[model samples]
Target: MRNSTIDLLKVLASQIIVIHHLLLYTPMSPVLQAEWPALLGLIADEGRYMVQIFLVIGGFLAAQSLLGLLGKARDVAVWPLFKKRYLRLAKPFWVAIAVAVLLGWLSSKIAMHSEISDLPTLAQLLAHVFLLHDIVGVEALSAGVWYVAIDLQLYAVLVLIAWASQKTGQLKFLEPAHALLLLASAMALASLWMWNRNAEHDEWAWYFFGAYGLGVVAHWAQRESKIVLSSLLIACVLGIAMWIEWRERLLLTGVTALLLMNSAQIERFVTLIVQGPVRWLGDISYSVFLIHYGVLVFASSVVIALGLTSVAEMLLAFVATWVVSVAAGWVLHRVVDR
Candidate 1:
């Protein structure tokens, strides 16, 4: 039940991340960093919204999938469930961390002060080790770790709901839609409180939780009726209007709703467009998201070594990064993921 639309959305979101990282180095041109670094920084500034989209989609799918499983399993056995998820995630994760380290080492000569470490300090290393660098006040880690954290949090929520669903007679006590609404409502209230309290941490929780809940609602929507065309139109309109705010990037949310409503119906056309390398990118996309920044670090150094000094060279660095990321994914799939 792989929806090509979801796969397509995943691939596109990964590219948005790439664009954000690319904006960071736009000032490496020396001239640009001096003359218009502020302007160059704008594109990447939107990276926050881009990351939000990823979080929402990941949250949405994780909840929908796990809840469905829980309804079927009818047990509170968390270990086996945890194991399956752990294997699927950690293998590719560790490989990416290793790659990030190597990149840090190779690019030491020209890296930003924070990244120029043969052995990153205790705090720095631990931040990355736990993917809590940004959370716990260490900003030296790469950008991709945030989504992993969000996914982990949502997974915890999903597992609990699944267990509850089973105990309650699998929708007899409280259906999935009611569960999603309750969760979404709780998250929204928490978000409001956080905003009022001047909390300075992880302001994107509402979007992530809402998206995950939407995903759950979408799953149920398909059973009631078909609404793909209507869902797409609304998602597009809302996504466009809220283009400026993280709270408003519900565009993909709508898309996710439509696809879930018509998962099988859309599969045929989606498969045609999503074929070839597009499908392949989705395979390695997890790796790309995890390690692209670190790969770019080494790539910057290599270009500096060859005395290449053009925007085009920077573009080539992106290519080099994908090569390493793709290879890293291959190794992880074989050794760690298995």
Candidate 2:
């Protein structure tokens, strides 16, 4: 059964991210900016924060899926789980990369724009194939590809932690599940207090583990019916972190975690309200995330080549691009992601 609330979050966050990239990377944004600088600036500045929602949701789902394994057996099949995760993330991802590279080449021939990625060297392409583009200092063929790599890394870390917990049951006091929770919480705190504050670590999963960990904890809280304690601890930790140094991203992460902790209560209401088009959007959100950049590059290049420079024309082009992105996402979902 699909969680409507999670779908709603995915739908909203994916659209915002698409718009953020459109504004940040496309040539048409300059014309829109001239007309509504404040609005465009606000989105361009803060829209990237929506990624926190995805990170939290990723961790939440990861925990949810692993709960069965953690509950049933003394040992997790770590390699199998990791392999499944990698294939689930990488299969559609590689397809999207091919689409992006081809579109980038086509876009360049139409108009030379910074959004169009240069031809990737064989090494760079291989790095991308292994999801090591960012770690290896290779340029990504598409925007936001780094997130896919980090998502896989974070899942791997969680899987290893769970496996370790099972092995370390020698700790007479703590059960494997409890130990897993404690270790995850400790890592979250370390990330919130130390790693996340350092920009240098942004490419790594540890830097974003705070937000991701909250989701993991939230899942356990919901499952164990310890919501109050879990919520309070999360709130206090995030509050203190923010008090020391305010970050809107962290604030959003905390909010997302709280909402997810209480998702069961509101799932029915959310499902009632979020239907039809909204549901479809959420269903294809991942596809949109993977394919929108390529569509945007193609759309923008076409607009530029045709000399659509007026405010009205550019605005229309932007709308057209957004619509095409969604449509393309639906197609990708149907063909590849399903």
Candidate 3:
């Protein structure tokens, strides 16, 4: 059964991210801001941080899959898990990249927007195919692809920790799974306190592991009396990071982690909604994240081609772009993901 609250968060976050990209890539925001300044500005400025919700949710689910509902280590090989993660993330990702590249070529022939990806070179294309574009210094073929690389890296790191804890006699005081989680939490602290503060490591998993680790911890905290200790540790690390530099991402991560730990407490009315459209959107959120940039580029080109300079026309274009992104994502989810 899906947690309604988590599904609600996923649906809401995905929409915020889409709206953020729409405002960022298109010229509709200036006119919209005049009428809805706070709403537009808020979406433009703060919506991108909703990616933290994704990180948290991703980490939580990954842990559940590998570690089981009780947070115990499954007697499974890490390599199989790695392969499964790659296939799942890369399948839809490749489809989205292809869509983006095609749309990018079309956009170049018609109109140019900063958000439109140019036709990528062989090296750039291969880098993206292998999910190494950020490391190889290639410009991304689309927005939000960087998160794909980061998410894969984070999962690989967890797999390594799990494998190491089992293969070695270290952390003998706790069960092997708990020991692995402990190691992850330690690394997450280092990330929040040190590595995350440095922008040089922004492309690496460690940079985002703090929030990801919190999610993993939150999953384990369920039904455990020792969770108070884990909760305090999370609070301290996040609090100290905030004191060093106040980041909205960090604050959101802290709150999201806390909320996820208590997600079962949601009202029954909310759970009913989750089994509906919210759950559908949440299931397809990854597809939406991957392909929305391409849809945005195509929409921007149409707006430019038609000379949509009026606020009313731009508003219509904006709505159409969103609908197209979601509708296309739903189809992609069915064709590629399912």
Candidate No. with top lDDT? 2
Query: What ranges in model 3 sit over 4 Å off?
Result: 69-73, 168-173, 223-229, 267-269
CA error at residue 258 for candidate 2, angstroms: 0.6
RMSD of each: 4.8, 1.3, 2.0
Candidate 3, overall lDDT?
A: 0.84
Query: What tens digits encode model 3's per-residue C-alpha lDDT throughout 28-96?
Result: 777787878888998999998999998998888777665662244345577888889988999999999
Residues forming the 10-long window of minimal summed lDDT in candidate 2: 66-75
Error of 3 at 117 (Å): 3.5
Ten contiguous residues with the weakest lDDT in model 1: 190-199
**Cα deviation of 86, candidate 2, in Å:** 0.5
Worst 10 residues of 3 by lDDT: 67-76
Candidate 1: C-alpha lDDT: 0.59
Cα error, candidate 2, residue 109 (Å):
1.6
Off by over 4 Å in 1: 26-43, 109-118, 122-127, 170-199, 203-207, 223-248, 311-319, 322-335
Give the higher-lDDT candidate: 1 or 2.
2
